[model samples]
Target chain A: MRVRVFADADWPQVWQIVHEVVRAQETFPYDPAMTDGQARDAWIEAPPGLTVVAVDRDRVVGTAKMGPNRSGPGAHVSTASFMVAAADRGRGVGTALLDFAVGWAKAEGYAAMQFNAVVETNRSAVELYRRHGFEVVGTVPRSFAHPTLGRVGLHVMYREF
Target chain B: MRVRVFADADWPQVWQIVHEVVRAQETFPYDPAMTDGQARDAWIEAPPGLTVVAVDRDRVVGTAKMGPNRSGPGAHVSTASFMVAAADRGRGVGTALLDFAVGWAKAEGYAAMQFNAVVETNRSAVELYRRHGFEVVGTVPRSFAHPTLGRVGLHVMYREF
Candidate 1:
């Protein structure tokens, strides 16, 4: 499946994916109090530059955003977050979205890419990032509060793309 | 320098140290609108089982907390953050706090440590974590808006400790 940048009209499908994903806040570390508008700000509302989505067979299956990882003279690296429809897992959708992110960050001249908070137990995502050459840099040690699990750890990984 | 865990009575000095280092939203990822109480919850209200502080000569130079990174089966790992008074930089205060977190996580049975939402622009802090054997694992590009820079990226890093 080919992936491309999301347009304004594509938000409906993105919202659907987000809506379902929000129900899994126990794992995502997103505000469990998140509403549509908040999701809009989180996923849409590209700040100056850097927002995109992934589509497959005419449906938006995944979404991700990328931009300057920091500011001041240190703002050379880029960062991104990705989401894929539950049904779309194991189809390489996430890799494609990450691929898009890497290309975009490189084109933007970012020195590297960083992911700030990945649930530590999300082993598959961690493995996928490791397969892509990202490294586990630093950890916050018990950050996000999962709904069902009570508490868990998060991972921060990065790569130069 | 040594790290210790204490209650709110220990907070005045802790806040003093943290405020000295993390005053500007530009320095930390916290909201510019965050109040003292909110920041306290963000730092103090862990999953009921983790908190800490760094003291140099019985005067708190820095403070931090650790606990389950998330809930459910994912709770095997821990996440933490540290804030050192600007005056205490380079005195091994941060290293001490981190060491405490590492030992505490190990003793508490966490499998790893993760950092969620590390500001990509915070080079010194990032580098410190790197020197401590952490790796940059994931990035949420431009997830935050800075007062001066408009938008900045967030980095997610982790280590097994």
Candidate 2:
């Protein structure tokens, strides 16, 4: 899979990936009733951020975004969010997206990285990040109410990459 | 120190902490120019949540808020925001606040806990949570724009306890 910063032309494909992945109401914390415009704003907002797409055989299969976690005095560290098409999980799409994020962060002079809310229910994503050096620094208990799982814990992970 | 739910009686002290700690322009992602009323509304907004203050000898030294990180279907796991007065730093007030939050969560039947947007520059806060068994799971690049730190990484940490 080849990953690259998304171009204007890539928005449609990338948006499709985000829509499908988020529509599940499982991985993302967004409102289940989120519209296309709002989702777009949520994913593609502000400055100094990377909205990238993963391509396989000229088809977009995954998407991710990387940007400064915050501004001013604590700007050195960066953060990222990743998503793989439901049909493409366990096939290395997440790993590739993470690799892109980490490489970009390190070269960009970020001192660390942080994830704010990872659904505790998503064990695969948690394991992937843990294997990649991230850790559960804190937990927001019952922050997300899962449809099937009921109340699920959201994991807050971080690493000094 | 006696820790209990915050009431109208604690507003003065709450404002003092917010003015002193949150006013630093580095510890939070919010703009330093926010007014007192706005901060209060953001922190203490009504039922189904609790705001607590730790009082030492009748003076407030620390404060925290516990509530749903997300509303509706995602409101099971509770999220908390804490602030300890700089003058009160080694007093274990933060631990008390955390303990209160965790116990409250456990009693409330949450499966896990997640801390969203933990500032990377806040080493003491991070270490405190780490000692409490929270792990950093994912990092968001440029999640918040800090006043002095330029860009800050937001850490998403979680613990299942």
Best model number under lDDT: 2
lDDT of 1 at A115: 76
How accurate locally is residue A142 in candidate 2, as Cα lDDT from 0 to 100?
65
For model 1, the superposed segments whose C-alpha errors exceed 4 Å read A45-48, B1-161
DockQ of each: 0.10, 0.19
Per-residue alpha-carbon lDDT of candidate 1 for residues B1-161, written as tens digits (9 for 90 to 100): 77777667888887676555454665565544555776677678555457787766778788888887654445666778888888778888878888888788889888787776677787877887888777776555555556677667666677875
Question: Which has the greatest TM-score?
Answer: 2
Return the TM-score for each candidate structure.
Answer: 0.55, 0.61
- iRMS, candidate 2, in Å: value is 4.9
TM-score of chain A of each: 0.92, 0.95
- Model 1's lDDT to the true fold? 0.72
Q: Least accurate stretch of 10 residues (summed lDDT) in model 2 chain A?
A: A69-78
Residue-level lDDT tens digits of model 2 in A79-161:
89998888888899999999999999998888888776688889999999999999886666566667788666667687885
